[model samples]
Target: MTTTVVIVGAGPTGLTLACGLARQGVAVRVLERAAAHATGSRGKTLNPRSLEILADLGLADGLAAVGRTHLPFRKYFDSAFVNETEPFAGARPSATTPYPASRWLQQPQLEQLLRERLADLGVTVELGAELVDVRQDAHGAEAVLADGRRIPAAYVVACDGGRSTVRKLLGIPFVGDGDPEPMMVCGDVEVEGLEPDAWHQWFGPQGAFMLCPFEGSTRWQLQASPETDAEGRTVPPSLESFQRLAARHTGREDLRLSDATWLSTWRINVRMAERYREGRVLLAGDCAHVHPTAGGLGMNTGIQDAWNLAWKLGYVVRGLAAPALLDTYQEERLPIAAWTLDVTSSGMAAVVKGIETPGIGVEAGGVGDFTGLSLGYGWSSLAGGGATDALKPGDRAPDAPCPGPDGAPGRLFEQFAGDHFTLLAFGPGARPALAGLPDHVRPVALDDPDGEARRAYGITGEALVLVRPDNHLALVAPATAPEQVRSYLEYLERLGA
Candidate 1:
């Protein structure tokens, strides 16, 4: 088989990349080693940033239908209720922060949603196909499947996992902290006597246990949240262990755990590949960086990796950008991944040290740091500094609930949902200057007396905000200075043409 890109692993990262590419009319093939879809609820929440990305991909409705906002967990100590706390008590929605809530979505549900979306775009996951070998040259790459099928592609991406076959095959050095000890066993199970409203957690001298209701399902996510190593590593989980853990921690014999739907144990992983690309092959998701699962950032970071890479790949494949443009994938995302690891590791360390104040909530997946809203490509060579306010060249394109062309009511995200370079002309004069922009460069003129967008993006006068296909700020130019917009587009033309 032949295609423009061959994606390894069908997790959120790979599926997300596939969808992004396919939507742009790029031929893509996805290979998964497993015979069936996953049952693991590994990544349970899509942080605000991830939610923003999904909204851009036109998945907000589907996610809103299936996913629910997380509620504060009511903590109980021993046999009695102690206090109710929230890891994100202070975090709330505002004009500046549109994605204020986290979507408590199960990983399996998220994947299935992506898969369905991919199917709508004429793509499907090729399961039960394991990569046995890979070979790459200057032109493209070839993969030898375990079942004796050979696939050729212009590029191959590994979203396999922490133990990625692609990363291992490339001999990339994974440099970071060792996996933390006394792992937490996680899975979904049904339990009795727990309120459906608030999540429940019990902390005691020995350890901690919790049962959080998994929205849209009968099961609740069960886990041990102890900071100390009160319990040692055991074998793979069974139903009996879950029952015992629940009975011992909550100190309530009435509550029972049964029918475990998923089971796995994992320690905090702090590692990043030295590089994400080699020859015609690349790595993404867990294959690229494995971090502490704190802040629900691992999967989100990996998904963003795919989000960042897909546009570059699409541009290159369609001869719209230079092959060197692909290099920016590592440049823009690796730092983000490194920063994510540091943040998550620090957060995990806090949990180990019990820094979550008794009455205050714990770190709700780094709710304070914008769950990636603060993440930007400020250090990338691609970011040019000519003008500055709050929204920098490398910052995320902020969303505002405003009107579209001809006073059509819409949000800022609607203009950026498709495959195009979004150009927001904040002034009327600037809109005329961008009137003849290329089809790929979409220009939207905003006339808001309230200056909702102007306040959010810090646009003083007529400003032109160029957003990359992945929705990151590409450039910010003065509306009076059409030369900057012309200059950047010329760069893309030169590289792509």
Candidate 2:
């Protein structure tokens, strides 16, 4: 039987993994419990770094089409306006950083776009086929569905959310506590008299309230502190609950909210999985880490987790890399998930205390920190030693205007496209392109006088930059690293073959 990858949960992460694997001709099956596509605005922002990754995956244009194009967030203190500015201001796109600004789209909208792209690759999610149980052995793994059908796969990834049955089945300890009390009641609602120009939030004595207009739709994401009696009892989460909270906090009888959907009493949960993998069954997305929604990092981080794992799995399945390569997924992602939990918790705590602006500095709980541009895996075993101060091994590979294979004006990221490792030789080098690279290793040569790529990459002269499939730098040498490339591939070959 052909080896197939079974992915549970059809959120952005699972679907993205399916898309990446499908493009590589790796057999994959996606199981979503929902009978139909989900609706409502859950995660609404896609940071700059995520846009770049999506652009490489061929979905950036579709996302830009549906997102609220770089809208600023407006803050208020009760009836008094505090300030209004671009949420990701100053992170503008340039020759090197092609997508520097963040974009906002409802989570459902983004998922649909991903599904469409996955469909183009001839893969469709199997809805209503929930994974009931999973068992793994030396050969592979088997997943039993609720419908009493069992399917075998080379590997299984549980992108199934916070209450993941896969996680529970693995007996992974999730150490975290809920806020006990609802910090706020949040949901999407159709409302009038509120402008959809910017994200609006109000802080006052009654409590904090937020009414951000959802772009591309006549709906607003309404968040408000629950009303409590003298006895400290709050009302149940409902449309009436939100209406009362909005009226009491905003004091704007003119503003009205109706047609509520996806209503829920918000609870704070910041937790990480004890382990990301067990034998052939792996955890991803909320199954691996659950962060407070403060930095908008939950979905973005999960998408990246899927991105990182997809390529690694593709390598192992293609027999180009060792199955042991799968271990690096946990080593690289576990720490990131923990750090994200801490940072986002800090952001949320600070916001509640009114100690910092919502979208300002990284430490001040702003876009600068959440963009993921600053994220790197310097500590990972995969990162090779380097001396460049500008672009270190494990750093995010920057994009720049450079010549394509045909010597025409092109972007460096275009070379990084597809399911492959990329070797970028900057300036004059002995080997402009490697002679005996695997079909997956794409190499490009030369540089520009404008010094765009050179400056961005910190390349003085002949330099070799080896970028991973997920666009993180694996090695950086002052000159060509032909031996290094061959050595790395050979290392994997010894284990895989």
Give the per-residue Cα lDDT of candidate 2 at 339. 84
Error of 2 at 79 (Å): 3.1
Residue-level lDDT tens digits of model 2 in 361-420? 222354237888889888887887674759777888888887866778888888888888
Candidate 1, residues 1-497, lDDT tens digits: the string is 24999999999999999999999999999999999999867778888888888777778888989857757778766646878866566777786566787878778998998999999999989999999888999888998899899999999989999999888888999988675564677778888877767778665555557677877688788777423324643646667778878777767889877889677776776889999899899999999888776677778887899889988899888877778888888988888887878878777766545523343224534523736777888777667545457778888877876686568777777788888898888878788767788888887888876888898888888878888888778888877877787778667656524
Assess candidate 1 and give its lDDT.
0.80
Residue 394 C-alpha lDDT in model 1: 83
- Worst 10-residue lDDT window for candidate 2 reads 355-364
- Please list the residue runs of candidate 2 whose C-alpha ends up more than 4 Å from where it truly belongs after superposition: 1-3, 229-231, 355-364, 478-481, 495-497
The top-ranked prediction according to TM-score is 2
Clashing pairs in 2: none
